[model samples]
Target: MEEKFDAIVVGAGPAGSACGYTLAKAGLNTLVVERGKFPGAKNMWGGAYYGPFLHELFPNFWEEAPVERYIKHRKFSFLTEDSALSVDFTTKKFDEPPYNGFSVLRAKFDRWLASKAEQAGAIVASGLQGDDLLWEGSKVSGIKAGGDDLPADVVVVCDGANSILAEKAGLRGDLSPKDMKQGVKEVIQLPREVIEQRFNLNGKEGIAWESLGTFTKGIPGGAFIYTNEDSLSIGVVVQLNALAEKNVKANDLLEEYKQHPEVASFLKDGKMVEYSAHLIPVSGKAMMPTLYGDGILVAGDAAAMTLATGLALEGANFAIASGAAAAETIIEAKKTGDFSKTTLSRYQTRLEQSFVLKDLETFKKAPHFLENPRLYEKYPEFVCDMAEKIFTNDGKPREKTMKLLKQAMDGRISFLQIIQDLWQIKRSI
Candidate 1:
């Protein structure tokens, strides 16, 4: 295929398909290349798709999109060996149109999204591995894939976190383990009614549960479970740097988390359907790579767009937003027929003006705060112990709340450490 196209997007994940779909919708020749058998065939997420990016492209997307469930319930937990302390919330407003988020299985969701690009006149080539950027002097002019050179006026790299094409094009440098995370997950199948009963959900309603502490063996990471139609997605994500210190494998961490009483009870009688491992970019804006250059623009995880603020881990929304922004910038560049760095620099400006960059910048200090060992270690233990102490009833005289808190915290964490962590959390979030 020697045909020169207007735009070639590598990796048909959220970012690539969003770009390709937008470009195609605007009457531009767009081609999306995916390494897997199809889009989402190799992709995985924690089952949450946030934001209205999809709604912007296809109004009322949930009506036909292969969404699992609208998230109406949310829970966060702190875990110790034998106890759990949690905060739970659910709202009826979240179940209506333009819901907050939905649970999704990438294999199905990505394929449906890529089909939208195809329907919009974009060519989606699956099973095509993007090997390297085809360069003309200092600028990328095309993509080299499966021994064929596919030319395009612009190349958008959205090939995920460890984007080899982006790195080879000098758009980003090597990533530090400190800024990366390793995730492993299992998809467990259960009866639809069983799922509803287990998670306490009604029709089309779902829960997103996240926990820290014992799950990671004290690593700087956490575990999550999202309810699907007839299944559950359970996983653990640990910092790459902390993996070595924790001396535990990703699967091992997941296994340990599964044995926790609170988690295991939900999975009873469920059959494991799939298992996968992935690399996650956890640092927010602080580690974002160069956004644009010459005829090439990088979006999604390639630009380190994931946000790992303790309260949430967000990527798909950012990817979708960045992808749309890249397409807009490319549209502007096409108007002038200039794909140089000066023209493509508009992509950076667009992102800055959008929530993609703003949210990242807002939580720029989050990665450091999340990395504090005390959070996943002593803090959770202390909280859980305090909860256990408060709830446990004995014949002996009861201790005051302050005394109970002191007892749980003393020797586990220093007083100064608690104050500092609280201050850091305040400043970071």
Candidate 2:
């Protein structure tokens, strides 16, 4: 006799683990399958997880999770070749219980999250690839993994940005370079005290720093530095289409970002311990796939659940939220013993009612706004130059602030262009 489960979750990342944990805890027999040697073994991100969904699932999870630090400080910088203009914000509120965000190493965190599912009675099968979806007529029945047909009532596709299972189920079509971003990252090890001193952090409080400017060589993405317990997660993310048009490699851009004066200062004496790269689905609703089908649902990057508003970049929270919603929908369907499209459609309804779809819809124009070339090129240069002019001591006579602003915009942009850009920024973000 063949074995069967109530649910089979593909990809043991945040989304898969959350769904599996939720289902198993709800008394449903769940199975989580991963292609990597272990959960998160092949995962990489900018190093921070935000929002309150995780706490809702596992209260005070940070108390036992492999989290590196609670992020209480955030900084955004606009950089030129040798100068940088930054906005830094820190607060004690973010340091309290149920902290706003945390810096985590995916390899450790993913395994820990998967273990949570296992502890909840879900059978987490790592090193097993979910090859394809088993179907009966038009409905998904289970998964084909490691040459075995593992039958299940419902299958949740939590695979990463390139999800073969979702594609095969006709949930998402081919992803275009225009809708994706390539991220290259490195984990540089440093002493704990040294890291705290350099980043101006205390205890487990950390910082997330983002930069946009010449470092990307006019690419549409940006650079980020996240503080960890004894390491720094630093990297560069760029739009795939823009990178190709400029004929530049993502890794080469990352190397250039590290060599920037302001960036180099933070990584001085740090030893590189790990290097990784991954793709990000950044187009929000524009690239979103069909969320649900008969006996099938997609969450996480597979469904383009990431948000990339100019002011913030988020994904983990959305992934976890979608996972929870999917689990709830499945649990409800289980009660009726009907795993058809009509029953599973509740997954989309749940997402729409939650922040997952709501936030994405609210910022649906962000992707188009972020693609403006001047944002990655001319704006940073103009801002830094304006700052230099305003603060220079060698000036014979200091000009008014508006005059300096005009000087900065002289050759780079026009007043009308600034107005237009600001208007778009307001509309999008």
Candidate 3:
């Protein structure tokens, strides 16, 4: 394993695979080391892969990739105990090529992506975990994995949200539970036609649904359901600190979410086939680690590159874009034969110039805004209460919508509180 390569990519998820594929495509000797038995074995995501980043790397990827469905609509649900309120957006244009987004199973998706890297001439070594970083004084020289030190001129660390190698290399400090989230999901098996019928989806079309309210026990988190080809990916993401404070297990919250009438309807007659959980960094760019150092670059979740902007939960897109940016920087360094921090700083600059950083910066206040308890508690309850009033037609004379809105707000929330919440939303968004 002492064989040196032009670049070594640790973690074969989207970010690592993208970096490996790009470097190898440029004829650089590249190696990908994955800790899992195979790429995506331990990876889990909420299902949608957004934007044009992946298309730039692999045009017509959906044609050959193991994509489950193309998302035709985005639905947001607000819930109370017995009631559910939602908003859905569907565009026919999104159904065309280079589609809006696709529902993916990470295990299958990552393997296909890793295979693409192999096809592009990168060596992929799976079932190998990087124990520590091999360093030359202040520079990262290679990766120490499975009792062997594999040398490389530059190392790209995309080792997920909880990255030990980044810490060992002094690239970042320990992650705080306050800044992370625990996500628990179940892949429910159902016939493809059955799933389509339940979700109102057509051929290869799917819906991405997210909900907020009593699901997480008033915790500052939410639940999601993404339609797959023959199954449904349903889960709940709860703030780690809130989970601890409430002394509730993530699985318990997911169970309660499943029992909700709205959620139960979707899972009717569906059998649970797989259960998985993960930790996600939700702190946006404020919690990000140094993007690059001498001979080393960190991309994807390892650098806290996830964006939770209320409207959408984005990770794969950031991971792929960051991986490409890191590869571009390394290619430049290889041309100059210098892997110094000064030259590698281009990785950060490239990310900044791209949508990866621009989008993150745009919604930097999201994490903090999400922390407000009112969002997951009072606001959803109020909205559902208002909806109940408006829709429940009684024998008596009907009241105006504005009157129902006032009735819903009265006693529960004050005018000042409403104004403050509105002001915060305006400022944060």
Identify the leading candidate in terms of TM-score. 2
Per-residue lDDT, model 3, residue 297, is: 96
Model 2 — TM-score against the truth? 0.99
Q: How many residue pairs clash in all the candidates, one count each?
A: 0, 0, 0
Measured on C-alpha atoms, candidate 3 has an lDDT of: 0.91
- The TM-score values for the models, in the order shown, are 0.98, 0.99, 0.98
**Which ranking of candidates, highest lDDT first?**
2, 3, 1
> lDDT value for candidate 2?
0.93
Model 1 misplacement above 4 A: none
Instruction: Encode model 3's per-residue lDDT on 269-290: one tens digit a residue.
Output: 9999999989999999889998
What tens digits encode model 1's per-residue C-alpha lDDT throughout 250-358?
8888998999998899999999999998888988776777888889999998888998898889999899889989999999899989999999998988988988888
Q: Each candidate: what lDDT?
A: 0.91, 0.93, 0.91
- Residue 23 in candidate 1 has what lDDT? 95
Q: For candidate 3, list the clashing residue pairs, or say none.
A: none
Instruction: Residues 1-429, candidate 2: write the lDDT tens digits.
Output: 998999999999999999999999999999999999999998999999998889989999999999999999999999988999999998879989999999999999999999999999999999999999999999999999999999999999999899898899998788899999999999999999999999888999999999999888888999999999999999988999988888999999899889999989899999999999999999999999898899999999889999999788888889888988999999999998999988888898899899999999999999999999899989999999999998898949778899999999998999999899999999999
Question: In candidate 2, where is summed lDDT lowest over 10 consecutive residues?
Answer: 390-399
